[model samples]
Target: MEMPSLYGRVLPSPPAVDFNSAEGKRLFSEALQGGTMEGFFSLISYFQTQSEPAFCGLASLSVVLNALAIDPGSRWKGPWRWFDESMLDCCEPLDKVKAQGITFGKVACLAHCSGANVQSFRANRATIHDFRRHLIRCASSQDCHLIASYHREPFKQTGTGHFSPIGGYHAGQDMALILDVARFKYPPHWVPLSLLWEAMNTTDESTGLHRGFMLISRHTAAPSLLYTVSCGNESWKSIAKYCVEDLPNLLKAESPDDVPTLLSHLIESLPANAGALIKWVVEVRRKEEGRPTLSKEEKERLFLKENVLQQVRDTKLFYEVHGQQYAKSCCSCSSSSEEDSLTRIAAAVCCQGVAMLSGNLASRDGLCCRETCIRCIQANGDGLKTVISGTVVSEGNEQAVDMLLPISSPYTSSCNSTVSDEIVNYPSNTDVLTVLLLSLHPNTWLGIKDEKLKAEFQALVSTDNLPDVLKQEIVHLRRQLVYLCKAEEAGSHVPPSH
Candidate 1:
């Protein structure tokens, strides 16, 4: 096996360290608090790790990714996960390269293509002082990370271009807090800004571009629908083959024991907002009647659409790269009766995370993800009403007469002749659900916090003419509301007088 050599010289050292020392422990504690770089030097939640021999660039990006809270798991308390080298290596664009290591340009390209917000700077045109001043300002908060790229050889390092997050900068001492991702080899320490700048000017053998810096900023965009919700997309087969077909290995569901762990990890990785949104969607979806079943022709056409296939590919790659889990071992699966069942379950759980994070964390019907759709409608002296465009009228779904009302099962078998007709003719269940959700909070879908409003909504659940599916959903929702109400009462909320 040919070993990695820089300038044809040998440097014997482990590629990374575990950071198990007392100082290492303290740093880890500080980082979890979301480290800072204020008048003093610190970076809370500046997640770090060891790098694979030739995966320094991938590893360094991972640190920046977490520090900027790019992944949903950044807010997690227990041991959190970040994108690993396996995921970065899985990139088809980067894989086509003939070079031994990733290039600076390629890393930036990959990050941007993956929906990561990034801004790069080259040392060739700028002075060290100019860069240092910027670093001091940007590093003042945990929302940005300065990924310094310089030649390691100048600093007596083995590699040509090395990358790590400059977590903190002390202007007084002209020192930079290097949160070295190559921890297996060395722990993080402060370095002279001038010396590090000299290293940045070194040339990279792969791209031939001078090594520089990139600040991975907070990813403000929501994950998109195309990136999640396979929802019987025909192109899913090819997408599975190309991108996440290796999910079994990526998620490491090698044994049955792994499934529960993977499940727990996936749930933990969900942001609090995403969880609330999911609950709202599932509840609202339960109220609707008849999902739009795909016809043979429409299903066949969608299965083969090039655009759909590409979407599946993007969604698959997105999860592998940004998924916050310890083991990338869940997705690898082969075609068999038993394994197929597990694969479907795992895929659904993982992909849902993508959907939840995206602006799509919405109604179960996959509608009303935007702020514009949320409108507040108050109740009258008689009862509640849905006011659309300033007019009061019976919505198609809620237009059912008392005779047509019958609580149905959640399963499809519950759809009877009367219900099926209503589903086809009055497909306004989602609109009604949308109004209900809007009533809670138009600005945020976190949850229904209004105890009095929730109490009033409970009356609607008891209507004799309500849909069975919707009623069952209300039952579940009431449980959540009960919990929320109790929590508020027990905590600090004061009840308002009528």
Candidate 2:
């Protein structure tokens, strides 16, 4: 007669078959030594559905066989158990199974580990503590960073020691720890896992240094979301692939021994846009509720539209050129042509200075020569002939000219010529002269004692040829000089001259 098979077909009993006795060694041998893949899968499937006692018994047997399969001194032994634990837990162990029976329970939790959940992680204190310890041990063996969970009260204040435990640790290093703390009771499932991976893989560009893993409740989220691991700036693509792709694969893997391999893949895949990726992930977590889910195309479009990369690129250009002062003066004489304020002021001052110097030189040349003496005297009635001719004669005659003629006469004639010149050049060089004269004190020229000078200045005041600007300045200066002279006369011993 044919022997019964564990699954499907039947075969003759092997020499080791002992159906009456339930032996751990025999069962493992049957599972592993089974020739076909069908037998192996059937055995595992049957083991998963068994009661706690039966499955635990089988688990113990599997453990022994696993140990014997590897050399005592090999590094593979510990890792093998870790792997078995993940697989057994995921597939439903044939051994003892805890029956807290939370909604979606272990199945959902395992699915979450594989990046299947949209809600945030919110485990009880006991669960969080247990998960943290396991993660720490596993990460340590693989030379990965360990992170811890931080918990605090909701809102009520008890005593100083009062605190409520929150979410558990995801990943991080010694210096900085990443906490997978929940903001709301129902966070989008991918948030916790994404945050965890970001904490683990972020690297700093400056020192190529990595930071400790960190996570805080939404209520307590840090101002900055980016975390760095190694010094170089990793790209967003690398970050997304490692955190979403590699880390999820790590959790679903059958052997704990594969942890190092998973970690190696993650570290090697660090992205160039790691910082930006972290920012995007955190932003998603925060705004996940009200915002519409972004499609891949929409995300790419928005990212490019915002032009963050372009802004970064343009920073230097903006500071170097566009930031400079481009202000221009809008004064009347600055040629209606737009120019900087400083440039306009400088040009005006320069033009005024040149005109004043030229006028002074012309007056001096005309007054000193006998040929031009009459014309200079008529133009600037300073008695230039008397002043200059006296010098050519004896010194004795020069004193008579100085004493007889009033000092005001020559200055008055110069003032008259300035007034007349303004009429000829109004709105041009006249405007320049008017501005200059307006800036001078009238008393300096008007106070001269020379009779001819006084007469000439009086005549200039009477000249109808003066431009409006020159006329206004002369009137203003005359009033000011009159007030000053009156004040001086009042204070002096000399009686006022009518």
Candidate 3:
């Protein structure tokens, strides 16, 4: 039986030469002969078709990461640690990437976050000579791969921007093999190196930066064992403002007697919405405290595994004890009246103060009735119960939470006024304090006079536990935080325009 030819899918010339074409075949052969097909041979086995229309960048990255044998350090599925499009979401949220394709800088950022040594070059920053030199080197090395972020319109492809790995280089013909991740639209092809460079030389209107390329290879050092920052520069700036600006003001205005209130205020003031809050909290494993089944040694081992800031653990432990005392003192109150019960529960310190900050004291101006407000309280309480009871698991990944909190008003029972469970379990003091410590050095809080508060906030700032690359990134963010805070202090601050 003869197979049907799918040559019609091959894009016409002036754009790219399809790999099955005679010219492309000859280019591949020559590339192999010239020993420049090392990357092609290494990457071919791991090449993937993008799962989403806007996932070209992630697909390209997964190919390169797997080719270099870089472990993702987390399970991609049951018992498998591998690179996938879903795991490449350390820089931008996957939903955002799904709506609008990733940018060149973000691609490099994701690569760096995923344990790769990444060197990114914007079209404006590097000469064509430099690109060609890097391209040739990448093509010749099995360990290194180059991903081009370019405008597809220049190649006559039906898209604005696209990302694909450069598999091989035909030095004689000056053509490069593009292992296009969008296999549904196009096949692997060869394009003139200069034409590819021209495509990359265009501007990405979204970033106001020229599109370019990234050289990615495996990092030789051990990856970060515990913490990694995931949010963008803008969010980091917001954290810095809250830490260095809003926090100091709050501290100065309040007394040590108002510590619980102060902690609640800090949690409520955080810039991260529900989704971001979830991401931050899940990084730290939840400790199963007061489990009689586990011995003290077992409990200590479990605490060590909850690889979060030591101060955060201590603060949580303190809150647990504090909350228990508050609950016991109020145990004698009557629960006959529903309204009184709701009010009493609302006022109680719950979810390590996250429930109080997010549900009870959280603004409810838009809510339609008392039931909706009560539901919010209940959902938050339930979510916290789920978190502390160690029942929060999605599929096999304990860190994931794909559930949404149903928040329908009574008047419109079918309305889609739902919130992510992430938001329901929003930033507690532990989470906000972590951000504060990350944004401003702990020494900045030395002005506090409360012995207990001082002990909680006095945890030494140490970057030694972080990977060198991530430490460098944190240092950069700290510097940016300082500059932003200084600009605001000078009264010359201008809000950024979206």
Candidate 4:
């Protein structure tokens, strides 16, 4: 059946050509028979109609994605097809595409996330020769396919701009086949080499970037992970595939619980990005332990100002993740009871201090949370009980109740602690509070061999307001017990979880 189009209805014109067919080639041969076709490849993909006529770019991308054998929530093997509606719903919503068409970055990112090898290049006046060469090279490879973006005016076509695939090239005719994605709007046809080149050189209005071609190949090695996820479970492999793509961004999530992780992958990914995390962590410790200096006023001003913005960022994330419901805003915090404040603070330490620091924290980054996330672990102590079943700790010397030290720096410590005795569970009389504090906030309890890591970590742990129970434990252990600086610094983000 014939399709309706505005171009034919509004003006006198011949039917648009579909070069992939025999009749169209006969027409091309009769009209512009300059040379025999050197290379030919074609994948007939349908055009889109739902969003706006302007969605030609998306339609073209959908075509490329399907041809590359990458799953976009569906079957990979195809005589190839791109359902624009499904693509929009899964990744770019329709309204978003309508407002400001997609970018090559977004398209490439989608392809990359789908496990395709994507190579893109923008065309310039001098680069056309190289582009032609690359096109021929790609045409020879079965796994390779191309998406081309060019303005329509140069071709004297109906639309202003469009995206389509260059299915075949004729060194003989010096004409390239444009497998137009808007085949419903304009039939697939051949445009002269010079005209197609001119069209690609046109600047796109949306991104202010010149139009170009992106080559996608499905056959490639596995994407490199900074570190391997240790799980042999297939379900976990799926989640890890989805999670690692955004792990760095997840690290900056507003709250520890905002992007919870499974205790499993957390044990894996933490080591890979620990350095990036500590970069911010050291700053947090510094701000919380800020002190008046005996140095000149100039030095002090710079020191305080350096961390001002970082402090705001850290606190913003903390409060945003645990807003009024759990940790109230500064204005309303004044009315909360002291007990509430202590409990909330303790929860924060348990979460951000250990879980987040060790990547034991999580959010729905696709790793199925086993209710061991920071929010769960910090919920009424029951969640934590499952993990810290080894032993209990006891309160000790009552004299150290208020031993708040004026910690000067994150790396330097005047005090020291070694095991006061053998590694044994806390005594039967050990306070429940002490056991909870020790087990939950063990980042400060594990030891470190790296002197520099130990110092920076020691300073942060020392800065924490030791609850009376912790103070009693510290005094009882004669301060011999060490916390988790080395455990985390062991060059892996995964700490030893009980």
Best by TM-score: 3
Error (Å) of candidate 3 at residue 40 is: 1.4
TM-score of every candidate relative to the true structure: 0.40, 0.13, 0.54, 0.42
Query: Runs in model 4 with CA error above 4 Å?
Result: 1-23, 27-42, 45-52, 73-85, 88-92, 224-498
**Which TM-score value belongs to model 3?**
0.54
Model 4 quality (TM-score): 0.42
- TM-score for candidate 1, residues paired by index: 0.40
- Once fitted onto the true fold, the runs of candidate 1 whose alpha carbons sit more than 4 angstroms away are 1-46, 72-82, 90-99, 223-498
Model 2 Cα lDDT, one tens digit per residue, 1-498: 996543322211221122223432344334233321121222223122112312321232223223223111111232222213223332233232433211112222222121121111223212334444444442233212122211111111111111111111223211111111121121111113333333323332322332222111111111111111111122333543444344445434422233233223323333434332221111111112233234454344333322322232233322222222222211233343222232333233233222222221222112221111101122132222111111111212111011011122112222234342221101121222222222233333343344564444333324244443333333433332222223112211111111
Better of 1 and 2 by lDDT: 1
Q: Weakest 10 consecutive residues, lDDT, candidate 2?
A: 397-406
* TM-score result, candidate 2: 0.13
**CA lDDT scores, all candidates in order:** 0.39, 0.25, 0.57, 0.39
lDDT of 3 by residue, 157-249 (tens): 777899999999998988888899999888899999889999999988987778888888885653432233434324554554566677777
Write the number of the candidate with greater TM-score, choosing between 3 and 4: 3
Better of 1 and 4 by TM-score: 4
Better of 2 and 4 by lDDT: 4
